[model samples]
Target chain A: MSTAVDTSAAVPLPAEGDGTPLKKRLRRAERRRNLLFGALILPLALVVLVAFIWPIGSLLTIGVDNPEIHDNLPRTLAVLEDWNGSAPPDEAAFRALADELAAAKGSPAIAAIAKRLNRENAGYRSLVMKTARKLPLDAAVPAREALVAIDAQWGELATWQAIHRAGGALTPFYLLAAIDRAIDADGDIVAAPEDERIYVDVLLRTFWMSLIVTVCCLALGFPVAYLMASLSTRHSNMLMIFVLLPFWTSVLVRVAAWIVLLQNEGLVNRLLMWLGLTDSPLQLLFNRFGVYVAMVHILLPFMVLPLYSVMKGISPVYMRAALSLGCPPFRSFWKIYFPQTLPGIGAGGLLVFIMCMGYYITPALLGGPKEQMLSYFIAFYTNQTINWGMAAALSAVLLAATLLLYMVYARYLGPTRVKYMKAR
Target chain B: MLQPYASPVERAWYFGMRGLVGLILAFLFLPILVIVPLSFNADSFLMYPMSGFSLRWYEEFATSPAWRQALMNSLIVSPLATLLAMVLGTLASIGLVRADFPGKALLTAVLISPMVVPVVVIGVAMYIFFAPLGLTGSYTGLVLAHAILGVPFVVTTVTATLQGFDFNLVRAASSLGANPVTTFFRVTLPMVAPGIISGGLFAFATSFDEVVVTLFLASPEQATLPRQMFAGIRENISPTIAAVATILIVLSTLMLMTLEWLRRRAERMRGARR
Candidate 1:
């Protein structure tokens, strides 16, 4: 550190070269600043990478990575590398398959391994298990014949193709499963079973339900948000607490409270019956109506806050000015006030809709089987089935859709997104 | 002239709207209020018109080993997550606000990703990523997972607060022979303390209420309060749950009041400084 200061003393003899010494000193200082800032950024970057980025990246990979076939049978994977879906994998490949399956027979990891291959062909596990025990054959012909002999299931080239394809740690199996498709032997993708085909429909339903909920929130929240914005700061702050109080409570508690309020035998029902509005209690809980009601209730404030904040900055004089110029109150509001607040509307709607799409517990508890969202299936695949590939694939679709929505918003409503995001 | 004090039409409309809003707000608070009274129910079912009032359910919650364990688990995890979030979030917030760099906007989005991503996705991702490392179902894993979820609140609150901070004080400290570390602790940290504390409260609230990630990450021995409640809901909708709910509502309301008070104090202090 002293050397840096001493260098200035040593260089004082030169006149024309004084700028060079100063520039060198300046560069050194800049370097120190850069290093210090770099040091500060490194840990944050690492934490984000380790805790967030890496997990999502792995999730994306987990959707496709079929490590069981590759890692468990390295020898066979090496053999099948050059085979290229042309002929039956040679005797060594069959032997390797048999050896690995036999090794994985009793382990819990087998379920995961079985799940990976099952995507390609229905009931591929029995074929794989049957072939495994009859292996270590003398020649290629006998090995291939034995695989065929195992319930005549392995004779179909598609089963072997999926198994061979799954050798890589990364595969499109999960992503395909997300959309109810899987790669066949000929590399053709097809729809899953009618029962399994419901996932794509669920994905669409999730989108539509979220959209409806977002729209409902905007409609209901607009007036309240306007009142908050139009009022004095103290009144607005008090009202804002009403909006924010729910946010402080547990989402689970709020949802549960809604169940108690909205159930058939609950408060709403009892009140309706007492008022003679209905003869019998309505089927409210564990249905789509309950889902929408609770979701909108829970999400309405998210819609209001951004709109309120943006509206606060907007003056009402424009509307009054327009009204005085012969425009009616309604027209003035539509043409002047509403357009100015479009940014808030877009921001809040996007935020709420995106959030509603990924909701799990609310839908899981309140919604019927038909109303269960895509997130429900993602959890099912990940937790209940141990099917990482399918979970990853579903999440990838979700991520892609979200990113796409963000991009579209940025392109069309750039300033508003920026504003709302900045305010947050 | 027979001038009426109020026109019936106008009077009805005014009262109607105000009454509706009042009803809606009351509706929002109904179950919360109901749970409090129901916690003292002598009968077990969560039906309307309680038979009698008693403290048996509250006693059950207090005496039951499982409920006590769950409350204890929440007590342990929430504070640890909050502290971790406070340190990491405050440090990152300083860097985020102090330095202008390329990709800062992207960095902000990345930092907040945990809040936006589906907890199911996070749960599964953590499960897969940590399973290989044997961190799954461990206290450290749950702590880290909850902290990840909590960090965004800290980041958000602290960042917002820092936006209002005067940077000249830090620069002045630097000019007066204070290095970056000393300047931060001596000048900047004190200024952002309120933000950090409020952020920590939010972090604590987020973790204490968190269930999805905890569901995926925890084993039976480590089940959190929400997880326990979730299981109990599936098993039976007992009055004991109502007791727990009442307790949780009380705790949450206190937390929210504290948060509001802290916010008001912060505003007053800022106004005074100005």
Candidate 2:
């Protein structure tokens, strides 16, 4: 390098070999590379746009998308616009609703509209369905009285209020209901009825459970991760297999294992009973304890890996220096060593917490009614109940929480090189 | 980890932490390893004190038509999904790492968002999105959804591998009258093959273990092993599930071993090259 520098100093600078300048040539090369990269990326970008981003981006909107009543009863919504919510709609409005219902009768559209309205008022499903069944009311008889005759709910302002609330193409009914809030007759958000207000509690419970799990994982994982970090590479690699093995194993398998071990007649309870720890088998399965155990066990690796990497990077010099400076071993260890591992703590804790927020099968299989988290309800609404709006709303909440934590992760903890990642 | 000058309390703490770490490591294996012995129990029940060590559950897993179907479906779907993910992910990774652009971080985030997004959300969203396109309840949609989940792993692994890539070699190849395509095929692909394969392995493992998306996107005919196990756990705690879980545990251990070995080999290759 010194010889090259001496020759360059002795000789004058050379001109560009080609017509183009070096900077321009570099710029052109970069631009070509960019074009090639852009072309290469197009396929994956398309796949992500079509299969990943677009679906999730649009699915979140379904939470506030209120199209059922708007599509099925368009004329009714138009007619109900001028009328106040103080009383039932006028004759023309009822006639418009009857006409729309008759037009939508015997099709899935009516059921969808009825489902949407039923969300507004509980019994309105039967009212709308019953009215739709006896549709195309005689033009001779007044449409209002005729509809009231089919179902007394059609005569009430509350039923009309529901249809009016669901009038818009995009309404916050499902989203509001997700947080246990509802729009009332006065167009004001109100607390959902006590009997139906399960979501707010569920959301809080999801976060609370996640927090508990994160703490438990950190506590359990810190020592192991620290030990692994302090160990030689061969020993640490041996220990990592235990973490990686469970991690790669199917979640269903882990949940299944928990069931076998935690049940009354399972190994755990039997051992406890045999050891005289308790006279009876503890109610370990189908409870919060079981859920915590499984979640912590599952997520502990996520905690350990990140912390291990961070801890691995921290030199032992500081601890040694602190010890030599007349400081207590434990105190100096904490004062010197602990602070540096903060980023790892933040990374792993946030990672495990973010993962816990979206947990489904663990809580579903292990925990009973009170233990069900937000994902449980998301699945319930999506599958069993087929309430896409409710499902979408619940999903939006969970997705937001996840993205927020991820942003925090990205911002604070650096790039998200997820666990079981890294070439090593 | 210990110092000779350490105090008595420090010594106790060290030993205590070591013992605690030991227990925690054991805890990690408990749920996974506990089920293995039970899978061999002669009895149908998932209980302690096995009637006798037997292969009845394994036989049941092999013979049962549903289990057979799940195994077949898993074998079929995981590979197809892995292929799709590997192709897209490798190409994307190459582009993403080679090209400099604004918002690359954002783009990377978007690419890998599938890994972070809740599975239930992905399942529902895919259902809603695919239903309109007539993709749901079909093998195509199932494969596509699995591919989406798998893509992030491939992208991440391949990207990381590409970061340490020597671009001078590509320049050298092109200067030697090799076209860009030949340069990529001959020089670039060979170097990054380990990363691509390991990433594909990750994708395969993900697809193999996936149950939530399958629940949403698949028909009964497309039930994967995990899906069947999910049903088994929910309805009845059969020893057959234990058998299935054991096989999966073995498979995962194998994958982990392959990944670790491949990682070492890749490191060695890079080391030798550098």
Candidate 3:
């Protein structure tokens, strides 16, 4: 290779840094750097494209695509296309509806279609199933009479319209459920049942818990991180073991530990009783209190790491200079030292808050049923009820909230956060 | 210890606050400390009054089929997922930190989004996404889901490590006739090994602990340890759970120790190499 390169050389080399050829080499090096950088980023971009973007796109489509409605009742839908949202249709539409319903009655499509339509109306399954048993003939009977002949419930026209409205590929069922509103029999948005109308509250609670956890972690972490930054690197490294130990521990173990410690006959109660602080054991487990304790413990490191990184970068000279300029020690520390650490505080806060919002396990295990977060319901709809539509909608809301907070952080706090990088 | 920095009035406040925070840190570790001793119980029930220190629970955990299976499942899934996460995440971290590209911030956010998004959401998403692909309840599905969750940790750690990286080293390598691939292997991966390893351990521990997503994505035949523990916890409270937990605590402690040592070694190595 060396011989070939030497033979191919067009001209003799001059001293380094003196030749115009250096510029060409520099350009080639620059191009190589660019290529390497591009090559490195391309794989990651592709991973994100497949992993995050594709799944989210498919998830969002669940809120609209009513495949069950489209697939199971093609003839009925096509015949009723000209029904014009008036009375349920003439005899031809009724006959088509009877035929489709009769065909789907015993098949998997009926159950699946029933499940989809039930999101619109809970009684749709029974109405469709009952109407299927009797296939009314096309005899020009009055609209009300024709429906009555098939099933008395169909005379109301609302159930028929639900099936009719859902005939289109897109449906508003999931989005409506997301807002705690569902389409009424008459096609109006109304509040869901009292028991089921809990998404709004769950969303609110998720926000509130996240906010509280962020505040708690920030309050606790700021001081510790500051101490770490101010101390010798030796001391800081030693202290970091405490932060990293929990990081290495399984979250499940941490929560389980909380369960044991917070129970009625747990260590805390034993200690309290031994100390004569309380005669009785406290009901500390399975509540918001437990949720907070475990969550704060688990998330404490998230808050501390960012703050430590930021604080480590700040020069102590600022505080010393302030003190030399006739400022009080405490005032200098507060005014100069604390202000610079704000970037860390904001970054840590945003990170902690965003993490807390998505908490599921600690809250699920330690929290009461009422204390469950939005993630709980999202899971329930997905696993128990198999309602993918509502799950997608709820997930969308969570995503939106997360994105909004991220936007706020990026727009407002991003620039100040640069101080978090240690100065070389 | 905190009082020297305090004023007359602030002295008492500092004492109380420092005492409280110290107590809180102790409290944070108390559960782990408590369980270690409990694992030596002679009796089957988990109670305060120790019947006598014995290794019976440990023996039971080691002997029970369910417990053994759960442990095996955890052992199998966590390391695999961790390795996958380390590879993808380190690659991603290098890309994210070293490369300047449009939508880099969004890309970073997307990479880390799995960390904050509810595991249940991930579970549900995987369930719906993987069901059609026939991946539900398989080792591959669970590992993929866990790797997705674990990637963010590796990326975060490696990115943090890379922030302190010297680009001049890469330039030096290139000037010495090393190709980009050679430079990355020689100069970059070695530098970030500690962060990568720590991130991998965190990723493994993360998957080991995760239950909700496992419950949704994994089948009964493929139940991971945490999923098994979850079933046991929900169905009945047993000393077996405590034993299982204690074993995990021990394993995690070992991993933590190794991580600490590796990190310290990496720091020293970096200093020496520089």
Which candidate wins on TM-score?
A: 2
Give the DockQ (C-alpha) for candidate 3: 0.36
Q: List ranges where model 2 is wrong by over 4 Å.
A: A1-30, A79-98, A111-163, A419-424, B1-6, B176-182
Query: Tens digit of lDDT per residue, candidate 2, span B1-274?
Result: 6999987887998899889988998899877888899999987889878899999889999999999999999998999999999999988887888667888888888988888888889989999899989898788999998998999899988988888778677768767877666777788788888889989998898899888889889989999888888888888878998888888888888988898889899878977976
Candidate 1 segments exceeding 4 Å error = A1-24, A72-124, A138-169, A406-424, B1-24, B171-187
Clashing pairs in 1: A64-A171, A65-A169, A174-A389
Write candidate 1's Cα lDDT for B97-193 as tens digits: 7555678888877877777677778888888888888888788999988988888778888888889988767657666867667676677777778
lDDT per residue (tens digit) for residues A20-98 in model 3? 6887766655555445555655665576567656777788788666799798889878877877766756766666666
Better of 1 and 3 by DockQ: 3
Question: Highest lDDT: which candidate?
Answer: 2
lDDT of 1 by residue, A1-424 (tens): 1122222323444355556686777656555544444355566667778977898898888776767767766777777787768666677776666666666766755665675576556687666555555544445456556666665655666666777777777776667767887666676787766677776788899999999999988887887777667667887787766766666666767776776677677888999999999999999988889999888877877787778878988887887799799996667889999999988898888878877878888888788898888788888988888766777888888877776776565566553323122100
Q: Give the docking tier of candidate 2.
A: medium
Prediction RMSDs, each to the true structure: 5.2, 5.4, 5.5
What is the docking quality class of candidate 1?
acceptable
TM-score, predicted candidate 1 vs. hidden true structure: 0.86
Chain B vs. true chain B: TM-score for each candidate?
Answer: 0.90, 0.93, 0.88
User: Highest DockQ, which number?
Assistant: 2
Worst 10 residues of 2 chain B by lDDT: B173-182
